[model samples]
Target: MFSLKKSQMFALIISSLIVGYTTTMINAKADSGYTVVKRMTGNNANVAYHLANNSKNTYLWNGIHTKAKANLRKYKNYSWRYYGKSLILSHNSKKSLYYYIQGITPNGNEASKIRGIVWHSYLTPGINPNYKQLNNIYYRYFNTDSEYLHYVQKSPSQKLTREVLKLFPNTHLSIQLTKAADGASPWAWASPRVDGYKNILEFPTVQKYFNKRFYKPNISDNTRFKLIKAGLDKSYSQTKRNALTQYQIGIYYYNNPHRLIDDEAPGFTIAIPE
Candidate 1:
C-alpha cells in the first residue's frame, strides 16, 4: 500500500480536479467558441420589413439553423423583433450576420407570438417600401397619422396623388394596404410566383396557431374545388375598411412584430395545406 504525506495528497487532489475540469469542457458550447451570441440590451431596430434585395422571397426561421429547417415562412408582416446586436460566429459557416427577432400575428395576441432568427440583409428597418420609401417622399393623405401605424395616410385623393408626385419628383409615394385580422389577397395587388416557396405548409407556426384555432388558412379557397391562387394580400388603409377574408387565396407567408406602422400586409411566401 502506498501512503502519501499531507502535502502530497493535496497535490494529487489538485491534479485530479484539473483533469476533471478539462474533460467536462471538451464539448461545451461556450468553451468551443462556436456560437458567440452575446445577449444585448436595447435592440437597434424597433420596426423592420422583410424585403430581400436580390432574392425574390424572404424567409423567417424558427431558430438559428445552419441548414434550412422544415419550418420556415416566406414572410410574416410584423414578425421581426430585433433581439439586440446579433453577430455570426464559427458555429455558423455561412459567415453572414443574423438578427434575432420575435414574430407576432393577428393583432399581436399572445397566442400568435413567436421568436425567430433572420438574415440581416433580408430585413430593412422602418416603413416597408410598399408603404413608404427610405430616401424618397412619403405621401400623407390624412392630416394626422394613426398611433398604430406611422407615416401612412389612407384614401389619397386624385388631387393629393398629383400633388405628392409633383413634390417628390420620381418618388412614387402610394397609399398601400396594411391589413390586420382579415383582408383579401388580390392577384392584381401582388406579384404571384411559385418558383421557390412551396414548403410553407410544413412550417411549425401553422400547427402552433392553427391548432389553437386562432386563425386557419382562412383565405385561400372557399369552394371545395381546391383552388390554388396566389396574389398580393392587401389590407385597406383604414383599419375598419380592411375587411377580413376567411376565403382562400394564393399568398406568401411572412413573420414580423415591430411593424406597428401598418396593419400588416404583403409578403413573398406562399402557403398550402399539409
Candidate 2:
C-alpha cells in the first residue's frame, strides 16, 4: 500500500467526487433495444442493402428520405458499430433500390438518411421495421405528429384554432374524435404537420418556459423542461436535436394531456399503438 499526504488524499477524494458527479449528470439512456445495425463501409454497402431488403417489408422511411439532401453514401459517413434498421423504399426497380439508411456516427444514437438508388446487391437485411420500437417511436412523434393522440383542454379555449387557421388558410383544426373509416373504432386528431406549427399549438407558458433557441432549459424548469431536454440531448447532431425536440414536446403533451388547440384537419391517419 502507498502512503499519501493529507493534501494528496483530499485531492484524490475530490477527483473521485467530481467523476461521480459528472457521470450522474450525464444524460445517459438505457439501450433503446434497436439491435439490428451492422457496421457498414463503402466496400460493404452493396451487401448490406441487399440483406436488408430480403428481410423485411421495407417502406420508404419517408421521414429520413425527405431530409437526405443527396446520395447518402457520398454525403454522410456510416458507422458499423451503431446502426438502426436499414430500410428499402417502396419503389424498387430492377437496377437499383432506394434506401432509408440508419447512419451512425461517433455520437451514440443512429442518424437517419435517404440514400438514393444503389445496386440491389448492396442492401443488407437487419431489424424488421415492424418490430423496430425505436423506429415506431420516431414515426409516431416525428413522422405522424402523434396523429391519433387525444387531448383535453387545459385552459379555456383561447381560440388557438382560429389563430392557427389565420396562418394556414387551407387548414382545419378541431379536437373531436371521429369514427374510423371502417367505423370499427374512433380516433382523435390534434397534431400539426406544417412547419413552425408547434409553436402555435403550444400553450404560451409551456412554449415560453422551454424555448431552446433563446435560452438553456433543463429539468430544473419542471417535467416539461426535463422531457424536452432529455429528448433533444438524446441526439448529438443539431438537426436531429431539432427533429427530436418535436417528439419531446409531444411527450410533454402526453404528460399534460391538455391542449390549447385540437386536431380536426385530416391530412393523414395511422393506428398507433400506445
Candidate 3:
C-alpha cells in the first residue's frame, strides 16, 4: 500500500479542482457568446450582404472593401466569438467598397448632375439625379461668369468633383431632361440669369450650390462658408434633430436585423430570453 502525506494529497486535489473549474468557465464563456456566420473573399460576394446581416445595428464606413475581405478569412465558416455593438472588419487590399447609403426624393434636384438622372423624371421612376453634367455646367458657368470665372480658371470644382467621384467614380451623368413635360426646354434655363425660366428654377439653386460645394475641400474657408454656417446654426432645432435621429435609427435597424445572427453566437445569448 502506498501512503501519501495528507497535506500533499489535499493540495493535489485542490489544484486539480481549480484547473477543472477554470477550463469549464472558459469553455462556457466561449460557448455563450456570438458566433461567426459566413466568410468569403471579395471574389465571393458584395458588402451589401454583411451590411444586411449584422445584428448590432452598426454603420459601415466608407471604403471598407479590404476589411470585409479580411473578415471573410478571419471568421471563416461561422466560428464563435464575442462582438459588442459592432465589429470592425479590416483588410490589406487597395480597393475598398464601403459607401454611404442615401435615399433621394424623386423631385429633389439639389445636385445639378443628379437632377435629370436621379431627380423625379418620367424616364427613371425611382432613380436619383446624376451630377456629371451639372459638374460640367458648374465649370461652364464658372468660366462664363465674370464673378465666378476665377473658380473655373482654377478648377475650384476639382475638390468637390473628387468628393462626388468617391461616391460613384464611374457614374455617368447622361440622363437628359428632354422627357420632362416641357421637354428639353426645362433644361434650357439652367442659368438663373436666363429670363422666362423661372418655372425651371422652382428647385432651389442655393440648395444645389450647397450640394456641389459640400464636396469641395475647405468649404468653410471658401464661398460656401456662409450657407454652411447658417445651416449649422439651425441644425440644433428639435424638429431637425428628431428627423435626423429617426432617419439614423431607420438606417441602423434596416442594416441590422435579428434574423441575421452569427452562427456561433446567437441573439438569445445577448438578451435574456424574454
By lDDT, who's the top model here? 1
Tell me which of candidates 2 and 3 scores higher on TM-score.
2
Q: What shift in Å separates residue 239 of candidate 3 from its native position after superposition?
A: 18
Candidate 2 off by > 4 Å: 1-142, 145-202, 220-274
TM per model?
A: 0.31, 0.23, 0.17
Candidate 1 global lDDT:
0.33
Q: Where is model 3 more than 4 Å wrong at Cα?
A: 1-50, 55-69, 72-188, 191-208, 211-216, 221-274
lDDT of 2: 0.29
Q: 159 in model 2: Cα distance from truth in Å? A: 27
lDDT of 3 at 217: 27
RMSD of 3: 22.6
For candidate 2, which ten residues in a row score worst on lDDT?
Answer: 177-186
lDDT of 3 at 197: 20
Candidate 3 per-residue lDDT over residues 86-129, each given as its tens digit: 22233332222222222221122222121100001111111112
Write candidate 1's Cα lDDT for 54-81 as tens digits: 2354444444444332122433333344
Scored against the true structure, residue 109 in model 3 reaches a CA lDDT of: 22
RMSD of 2: 19.6
TM-score of decoy 2:
0.23
Model 3 TM = 0.17
